[model samples]
Structure formats: C-alpha cells, structure tokens
Target: MHASATRLPSAAAWTVGDITVRRIDEIALPPQTGPWLLPGATPEVVSQLPWLKPDFADETNVLRLASHSFALTVDGMRVLIDTGIGNAKTRANPAWHDLDTDYLTRLAAIGFTPESVDLVLLTHLHTDHVGWNTRAEGGSWVPTFPNARYLTTRTEWDFWSTTELDEPRTQMFRDSIHPIRDAGLLDVVDVSAEGTTVAPGLTLLPTPGHTPGQVAVRIDSRGATALVTGDCVHHPVQLADDALGSCVDIDPEQATATRRALLASLAGTDTLVLGSHFPAPTAGHVVTDGDAYRFLPYGM
Candidate 1:
C-alpha cells in the first residue's frame, strides 16, 4: 500500500431483489484532469455537466476514476467481477508496477477469502482487470483463488493468447493469466450466444470493442436488473457526449457505438448500471437527458 493511502469506508453493498452486489476498492484516485484522461473531456465541456460535481468530479472539474472490483453473492456462491491490480506484479506504468495492497484482506473483511470465491469473471484480459487472477508465490506466479474457476470469452482468450503484445503487457499475461490456465482452472465460454448464464439470474452480454471479446454482466432477479459495465463506458461524461471515446480504446469507433447502444437500451429504465472504473457510489441508472444521456447515480 502507498504510505499516503486514503482509508475509505467499509465496502458498500446494494441489493437487486435477492442478489447482493458489494464494492471492494483497490484504490480511490485523486482528481485527474479531463484533457489528460479523456481528450474530449475538455475543461469547457466538463464544466457544462454540473451533474458531475462532488462525487464524479471535484470543485476544479477534474474527473474522479477508481480501480476496484465487485463481489456478487447469490445462489450460495461468491462471484468476483474483476480483480484490480495485484501485489508484486511487473507493470509498464510505474504507478501500477510492483507494489502491495490489502485487496484480499478487504475481501476477507467482507466475508470472502481467495478460496471462498466460486467464480472469477474477467470482462476482458486487460492488465488491470486480470491482475489478481494470480499472485507471486515463492518467486513464481500461482492462481490466487485456488478453488475458483476463471471465466473468459473464447474470442478474448484467442485474441490475447495469439496476438503480439508489448513487453509489459506480455508480462501481465505471463504473471496473471497463463498461471490460471496452467492450473486447469480457466474456462473460455462462447459469448456470441444470446446470453451466457453464469448462474440463475446472472448472465454475460458481449459488448466488444474496448477489446474484441469484452463483455458486460447482466443480473436479473425478481424483475430487478443491473449491468456491470466493463470499460464500455469508462466515465459518466461519456453518457452526456457519445462523441468522446477512451484514449486507450482498441477500436474507438466500435467502442463509441457500443457505449451509445448500451446507454440507449438502458436509458429511462430501472436497470442498475455499475461501472468498473467509476468512482465511489459506482452503482446508478442511466437516464435520457435531452438528445444525449446522463448517469443518475444511486441515491441522487
């Protein structure tokens, strides 16, 4: 952990009917300038979205972005949505390189340990999303959740395993992903199906373009619904302006289209939207705001 790490409150949980979704934070970042993070998120543009103030943005209008994971508990199983950057891993970005945090400790506090996790789902095989899939053990990487089965789309697995990646990213695969497969615990599913059901009320919806096989988890129970957005819409600002795209998107045009379509489908509906990188109070509902859309965060 960083010496100046900020201590956030205990993980918060929200219920969609009988299922409970909990947030376990790895890091809550300080304000980051709009232009630096999202080119289209200029000061002038972000300033106009007054709804961003306080929670999503600060007084100066800098956007707040965090890296965390969600725990979905139902049907007598513990499902981890995405694993944030793990401890002692080699990363290209200095900020993410070789470090430590009490991610598992926090999970334990919320009544889960590595072994207790029944399933580990990765929206995509990005460095940040798959970091905790494995951990350093006696100078070798090993699956962190010994008993859990890690799930990834067949398309995603094929793409990453065969495509040439940079040294750092390749290292990410070596340390976090391959070990799980080596342990005979990784399962590649067909995401092209109408919906891939992980449990009774939980399903995976393909929302490619952030990565070729990226997916979003949809939960429906007792008529209550929620969508776990996996970088499809990184920030609430994207909801207000569909033209803006993430600087790191693999296919910007496809990503933008996916975001617009996803937002359009859920706008004005009651489906809860939980963003993978959204700041605190990350659960919300997407509502139509004029020709564009806006994120109506929970409790606001």
Candidate 2:
C-alpha cells in the first residue's frame, strides 16, 4: 500500500524451497537534479514505461520515489543485497547529506534485526550503495552491524581504496568503507570466477562495468534463483535499448554488454530480476514484446 503516486507496487514471491523472500525497502525517488531541456522526448515514449518517467519530466509532483534495495533471506540469515543512502553523511553536495534512513528499523518490522544479518553484500562502492556500512559510535564512525560481515569484491575494494576519487566518491569510501575496514568487519572477496558462493546458496555473479568490479548477487534456494542486478541496469528501460547507459556508468559499452547478457539468461527462466533503481518491489521477469522485451513486474 506504500505505492508511489507516480508508480505502482509490485511483488511476487515463493520459496525456492525453504528460503523466505522479501523486498525490505526502497530509497525513494529523488527529486530532479536538472532543468527540463529535452525537446525530442515524446510522452508516448515516456509515460508508457513507468521507469522512463524520470527521463521525460519530473515525477516528484506525484511520486515519492526513492532508490531500491533488497533483502534475501536464506536459512536463518538475512542477507542485505545493498544499502540505500545512509541517514547522514558529508559529501560535495548538501543534497547527499541529511537524508533519512530507517533501514534497521524497517528490517526489524519484517522480523530482521542487525544481528540477524550475517552478511552485507555491496554490489559496488558508490556512496548510495554503501550508506549503511557504518553508524555514529561515540565520536567515531563504526560498523553499523557489528555482527555482520560486509562483503565487497576484491577488484572493487582494491580500486576504490587505492584510486583517488573526486570529493564526493572519495567521501563515500571514507564513510561507508574505511570505517568497516577499521572495525575489521569488511571482507574483500574474489568473485572473479564464474561466481563464488559466500554462503550455502548465495553467490556473487560478477557484472562489472558500472564500476571495475561491480557484481550482481544470485541466490539459489529451494530450486529458485533471484538475481540482484545491482546497477548493471539501473532503469528497466535499458533492457529495451541496451545502448543507453547511465551518466555514472564507468564503461558504457561494457555495461551494455553485461546488462543484455544477464537479462537474456534470465529472460524465460524462473530467475527473478531485481534492479537496484527499479521501482519498489523492484522485481520482475522479462517477456518478449516483439523485437524488444518488456519487464513484467511481479504481482503478489
């Protein structure tokens, strides 16, 4: 019932066998960051695709859209795929600071607590992706979930920790990653192989290009599998046109390649696609709509 005025709520879940599935919370749609300047964009091409509304005009008038994140519950462990924007932090821009996040509380409402989380899987090192990695401890930033092991790909960890980033992205690592590392809770993982199973059924599938070592998590349990697409395909509209990469994409060509291949493999299978920025209940299946495929949001 928490549907955005400009978007609809869609969720469909069933056990792969014994694993429980749930979409914990969304980051909510952010307000437009630019003035409307496009001229060729048509309403017909925009409004028809719910995910394309942001590209047409501001939807903030009607929708309280936020970013998206997912919780994959397997065994007795609750694995959070990605952490949305953290509550408060310093950045190059004020917009990224002072945001509200009730993530831990939200998880608790669904019977998950910080201690119930055994692993925190970071798809990449973007600020928004790692916001909840730490919390204020006395006068220091400490691991938010002292009991959880935060997992990040070795490639990503090496690059961000070593590379010199602009003020914003640099601040991101300083806040979300450094603190966890200092706390001895950050795990640098090598997921360069086909995939690596962090737990019994949760695997990290490398889907780099959004960043050097970006990855999407695949969870298999009870004969069911779900792909947390991270930022491989930020908006569902990209599935229709793989050439369109986001401004933040580090390698547009590679990202497009990664997106298509991943979506194709899950197109007609039992695999459910979970996109990081897709609308809440951000999961669905791909269906052929003539030459282009369309996303059918799961209905539960």
**Could you tell me the C-alpha RMSD of candidate 1 in Å?**
4.9
lDDT of 2 by residue, 108-167 (tens): 776667767788999998877888877776876787778999999999888877887888
Runs in model 2 with CA error above 4 Å?
Answer: 1-14, 33-65, 93-95
TM-score of 1: 0.94
The parts of candidate 1 lying over 4 Å away from their true place are 1-9, 30-36
TM-score of each: 0.94, 0.85
lDDT of 1 by residue, 190-245 (tens): 97647789778889998888898999999887888888999898889999998798
What value of lDDT does candidate 2 attain over all alpha carbons? 0.69
TM-score of 2: 0.85
lDDT of 1: 0.85
Instruction: Write down the worst ten-residue block by lDDT for model 2.
Output: 1-10
